[model samples]
Each structure stands twice: as C-alpha cells, then as structure tokens.
Target: MSILSGILITLIFLGIFISPIIGIIAGPKIQWNNQMKDSCEYFDTRISMGTHFPESQYNIRSLDQSVHDQTFFLAPVFAPQADITAKYQYYHRFSGNTANTAHLAIDVDLENAIWRMMELDGPDERTKWAAVGRKRDNAALPAFENVNQTVIYNGTIEQLGPHLWIPDFMMLIQGIDDARQHCEIEPFIRVFDVQGAPIEYYESLIQPKWNWSPEWDEYLMMRTASFGLGRQRLDMCVRENNFRTFEFEEDKYKGVSDISFVPLAIIASYRMRFSEIGRLDCSKDIMDKARDMI
Candidate 1:
C-alpha cells in the first residue's frame, strides 16, 4: 500500500476510536451530572434520620400458635416485616422506648413434643430416642444438637406470625419466664431514592401483612430512622458527586449493637408491570441518579 493510503487508514481508525471519548468529554450536555445534582437535593429533602438495628431480628416467624403442638413445626423462614408506622407509634406511646421501635421479631415455633423430648434426657438422649434404641451408644448420638437432629425434626420458620409461643420446656431450659422475652433484630437499611421517596414506599408494595410483636418495636424505629438519614445522604451525593458525607451521630439501645454511621448509596432495579409503569419509572430514575452520585 502507498504511504498516503496507510496514513489515511490510520487517521480513520484513530478518529473512530477517539470520537466517543471526545463526545463524552465535550458533548453539548450529559444529563448524568445534572441528574446527580438533582438526586442529591432530592435525597436531602427526603431523608429525615439515620439509624441502625441488630442482625438477628430480620427472621420472620409464623403467627399460628396452634402449630407448636405438633411434632413438626410448620412454617417458612422469610424476610422480616418492614412496616414501622403503626408499630412505632404504638411503641412510643406504650413502651416509651422510641429508639428501637421499628424492629421485627425472629419467630421460631417450638414443638411441644420436641421440647419434652429434649427435657427428658437432653439432646443426646433425644437423638438416641429418635434412633429407636438401635443406636444408643452410637458416637453420632452425642453430636446431634437442636430439634432438627431429633426423629421428628421440622424446619425453621422465619416469618411474621400472629401468636408467638415459647414451649414450657424451653422456658425452663433457658431460665426465662417465657420464650417471648427472647427477641432478635435483623440488620437492614432504609433509604430514599434521590427523588425523596422512602424505601418503605417500595417495600410495602411487595411485603405481606402480619402482626407486630412488642419485642420488634426498637428494630422498626431504627430502620425508619435510617431510611430518613439515607434520604439525606443520598441528597448530598447528588449535589456534589465527589463530596463525602456521613451520619452525624447514632444512638444505641438495649439488645442492639454494632451501629454503623457510614454514608452509603444503593442502586436497585425492578421490572414493573405495565400497569405500574408510571410510578416505577419516576422512582427508578430518581434511584438511578442517586446511585450515580454515590
């Protein structure tokens, strides 16, 4: 090929490669920067607080009290309830402990038969009993732990339940007046999209209806407060993409630990049914901008 032809080809290739870069750097307008700015403002206006909850409370328990009497407790482990509006108000009024009112409980149904079996001779004995005296001296017998290891083992239930019960044997074993006294908190974060919409607004569309336990009140409060703070932090990021921000202070409560005050931004996407397109699109755009800023 001639020298001129070679030079022409190289120039064309270079232009093709560098054109996009130049466009990105010097385009008439890229909406991302403006979008980010708007997102930050949106989050700032939306977020009202920041808070933390423990990691244990997110497990949902079945509400059926009747399920406990059977040999196998029937239920499913699922996401903790995120509704805080009603529970928070009730806790604030009744318990006077507002910091953790938004919490949810980890419900585990204790089978009466399993509880009785465990009490009769401890876990090892229960394992032997399950073996029907065939493996009384089996080495594996001592290794068995929990009701799951017994003959009539049932799965764990982690969903919201109506009535939570602690088997009498469990109360005696744990030295607690009732199983209801043992509450757990799950770790969760609540934030707003850059457009100032609360995360709970998104959650409520998909979550199930369940009753709240007094034990979960504090968890709920912290989660609600975090959503508020997340809104603020998201706002700050949108305004100044390079700037760093964080929660100023976080308060602690009984049974809650390892509180985090770091700044965070999250991007999530969900396919909305055609009927729900309008709201989803608006919310998704706001969330996308917030994510970019972060």
Candidate 2:
C-alpha cells in the first residue's frame, strides 16, 4: 500500500482505541441537578402481560379466544397522542367472576375500593376520592384521566371489579397511609361478612411484574428496554400473607414482603418494604409465547 493509505489506516485504528480512554478519563457523564416530575411516576418493575391487569382474561382485547391468556399486554402510559381506547385498555382488573371471593380479593366492593385520588381540579365534585384542599373543594381545573374504574353490569349482579392505576410508588403509599392512620400502625383489614354481606380479604395488593419482546416481534411498547438492561429482577415490596413466601431466581433475596391487603381502600396503611420481586426471563419474548400457543 502507498504511504498515504497506510497512514490513514493506522490513524483510524488509533482513533478507535483512544476515544474510549479519553472519555473515561474526562468524566463520561455530566452531572445535573435532580428534577422531579410531580405529576407522573416511573415504575421500577414493569408489568408482565402475564400479570393479571384485568381480573379476567376474557375482557382483554384479543382477536383470538383460546389464547386470551397468552396475549402480551401492559398498562400503557397515558399519551395524549395515542388512542386512549386501545392503549389504556391493557392495565385493569375487571372480573366477571360470580364466586364469593371476587377479583382475587384485590377487590371486595367496587365503588369504595379507593377512598380518594390525587388530581388537580378533577371533574365530578361527587368524586369519592378527590383530595379536598390540594386544588380546592371549589376551584375548577381541567380534568385529568385516572386509569382506575369500576363497572357495574347492566342487568346482572355479576360485575367487573375495579383496579385503579396502581402506580408503583411505595413512598407515596406511606404518605397516603399517614393521611388516614395519623402515625398509628394498624392491622390489615380482615374481611368478614358484615350483616350477611360476604367480604373478601386479599393476601397481597401488588406483586412484581415484567415484560420481554424479541427483535422480530416489532410492536409498540413491547420492545425490550431500549438500553438493554438485561435480566433484571423486578424488586418490589408488596402486601402479602403469612402463609406464602415469595421466592426469586436461585433463591436470591427470598421472602421480602409480608404486607396484607386492606379492603375497600386501595392505598391502605400496612405496606412497608421493598423485598419481593418478579424476575425477567430475558431468554425469550412475545415471539416465544405466540409460537407456543399456536
């Protein structure tokens, strides 16, 4: 090769080798002041399409009937541009179960599951869960969408229970509890029939959830984390019962949750800890599920 060509090739190789070294030595990242989004929350553990968003799989929007359980879905972040009808349909707990223990004990009564919600100038002053003094008992602000809803069937007692937008914020959970309990630790709600009314007590309120999608299975919000945080454990501290022990991969970080459910109050006062986890199976994705069900 000519001397000029040789020099060019040698310089190219050196540039590749030296760039990384310079980056590490000169502080790779710029440190900036922390800013918090008071409006929205970022969840550490993502929901697995496998996790029951809606209480019954039959309600999930699926083209195929037999494979409803295999449908891959997660609660979509409320994007103004996205179609609300389709996107937000993924995360909910609606049950048609007529059994006495409805919605897996996550819900006992539909209307009163959550006592109140934190929203600015929410419509429906009749809203049961509005925070009274934050915005106002009278100030009129634009209505913000909350993913929580309870549907009572038209002509039947069997109705779908409500599972609100369960934001994965344990600290927020504590704040909510403090508002109600006022520094007093109370026992979880022990559901029992009140005056012949059957009440269901759930052992757990939340559990770790995850999602995975292969490169070939290109779909919205299904792609694995763009940054490729592979094979992470969805660490969480959710309400659970004394009988069950939540175990993770290889028995690592075993038994980190014991929070029991508080009926009629979605954000109750007993949850404290970040010990439970649902691990991600990075080896396969939606393609694997589709093929297996087919």
For each of the candidates, give the backbone clash count: 31, 7
Error of 1 at 199 (Å): 31
In angstroms, the error of model 2 at 98 is 17
Residue-wise lDDT of candidate 2 within 1-294, one digit each (tens)?
699999999999999999888666643231100111110122112122111111111122212233222111111111243665432222112222111122221222222223221112222222212222224566666455643334321110111121122222111121223212221111111121122122231112211121111212111111111111221221121211111222211222211111112221232111110001111122124335656899
Candidate 2 clashes: the total is: 7
Give me the overall lDDT of model 2.
0.23
For residue 116, give model 2's deviation from the true position in Å.
21
lDDT per residue as tens, model 1, 1-294: 699999999999999999899777755334333322322221211222111111111112112332111011111222334664222111100001111223111122222111111111222333233323433466343444543312211122111231211222111111111112221111122221121225564344123342222122211211221112112211111111112112323333322211111111001101111112333322345556667999
lDDT of all predictions: 0.23, 0.23
How does residue 18 of candidate 2 score in lDDT?
97
The reply for model 2, stretches above 4 Å from the true place, is 22-294
Error of 1 at 263 (Å): 8.5
Worst 10 residues of 2 by lDDT: 269-278
Looking at candidate 1, the ten consecutive residues that score lowest on lDDT are: 89-98
